[model samples]
Target: MADEKPDFEVPVGLFEDFEDLKAQVARLTAQLQTLTEGAGEEADEASADDVTAGAEEADRGDAPEDEWQYPPFILLLDPPQYDDELRALTEWVEGVLVPGYLAEPSSDARWCHLWFEHPVAVARLHALWLAWQELTDPASCGYTGPSVWHRDHLDPSMRELRGSSGPFAGCTKGEHQIDHRIPGLVPSAWRQNDA
Candidate 1:
């Protein structure tokens, strides 16, 4: 067969139909909300549903139990940018969060005791954990939110930080990775320096 490009199709004129697109999106959103609300049995059962909605509302007040609420993240850091902030954040993550989480009975097997060595890995993993918390907040996060979080954030970060081709690839020694140390405790790396 002669070389040929496959036929492609798109709306004939989208620029002229901005209002139409907005209307369509509004309709779809309403439909999605309707489907998401389902038979209204949950509304009947949930007293708190009358008060607030979605992630923003969840930030306002305590949500009722029996919803998909996730506890506040215990390991949150400041928007760590400067050297001081980074040092503090790294300290908290490695010295506090990692050790504390590992001690917890609920800590996941996949992450347990996996020393995240690289600074980027530390920051990225912390960010992912924070996103997971936000995505699992039942009051604001939709039913599929956690699934989205898993697909979009957890899967990719885990792969990059722990995958065979990624940061922790050669770092593991059996169940343990020897390449990492608690960041705050690494005197060699963090020794006080005069600029």
Candidate 2:
């Protein structure tokens, strides 16, 4: 008998709860790390007000010039940043997007397990994730944010990402195209002139 994948049904709301818990845990961990580091510093150098202000700034999602910026475009990031962002993107795609939205794939609708290897797919999915983060944040977008996200971002992104002529075109539901190649662009006129 062929091995079949187990089908475990997950409640839709559970993903959201999990995400919230993760965010909370991350925030607490960061705070703990900051406090621990501060403890090591000369006590007089780090004032209570300074710590409080830094915490408040973090709570407000404010960052100094050197801090990591959000909604980073995958293609534009440096290698280390790209790897970190790609890992997070993969988690979001596999853990949340696919589980919640992607339907059983067909000839018309497709998905590639190696989507991250496809540059176009990576760019598109990164954009979608960036929008998701912005729209889903209660501080940035209020109660109606999720609705706006679905209407303005999710629908179009998903359609394009899974469309028959999209990045995963040659891939199928049951199999990934190992030799999938991105179509080449026209040779640069400048390079031709140089030649």
Candidate 3:
């Protein structure tokens, strides 16, 4: 019988109601999409022929000389000249590692694609460094020596290689996997020689 009789009334306005705000946002988004779609309607209809012609031009590899000049990311092909460690590493990659790796027929495609993906060719260079480090580092060199592969070496390579001017060029029907790097390589190659 201790104070079990009466309790205070619960507050009515505890939670913030955002239904009006949410409705406004939904209406605005719909309006924006409609506006943008309307704006592009004419361009979309008129560009069909132009788009096809442009694609044909691109197919001929006559897009434009300037087009070959890649974005800032592509300039990383060569490592920065300032950092000694990176510079040495890059040089080693270009001069030593890639050449050795490419000598193997099986890995040629894998490494090539890896080189293409490097905004600055860092992947291939790093792969080489990792290979070298494998020779030096005692712990996990052979086990996980940088597993970078060239971009053009994988199934994408197969697509491009087949796509440009071959029987499979337009045949987009097939099971293809993007082989980013050498898959299923044994860890022993990455280990230090002595280790």
Better of 1 and 3 by TM-score: 1
lDDT of each: 0.55, 0.82, 0.43
lDDT of 3 by residue, 1-195 (tens): 796978686443321124334545675787798779869777657677888888899798575553433222222333453255455666775676556544432322223323333322453344434445443432322222222223323223333333334222222323223433444856563344554
The per-candidate count of clashes, in order, stands at: 2, 0, 19
Task: Identify the runs in model 3 with alpha carbons over 4 angstroms from their true place.
Answer: 1-86, 104-120, 131-136, 139-195
Better of 1 and 3 by lDDT: 1
Per-model TM-score on C-alpha atoms: 0.35, 0.58, 0.22
In model 1, the runs with Cα more than 4 Å from the true position are 1-116, 174-195
lDDT of 2 by residue, 1-195 (tens): 469888899997787666667766776787798779858889678889998999999999799875557665788777898999999999999998999998888777788889998888999999889888888885445445688789998999888988988888888767776466645776653334333
* lDDT value for model 1: 0.55
Model 1 residue 110 CA deviation (Å) reads: 9.5
Name the lDDT value of residue 30 in candidate 1: 75
Candidate RMSDs in Å, in order, are: 15.5, 14.9, 21.1
Model 1, span 1-195: residue lDDT tens: 478878987664554255445655775787788667776566567555554365555787655564446433323333433445455545766775567543322212234344444555666766776676666764345445577787998677765655555545445344545454346654554345567
Best candidate, lDDT-wise?
A: 2
By how many angstroms RMSD does model 1 differ from the true structure?
15.5
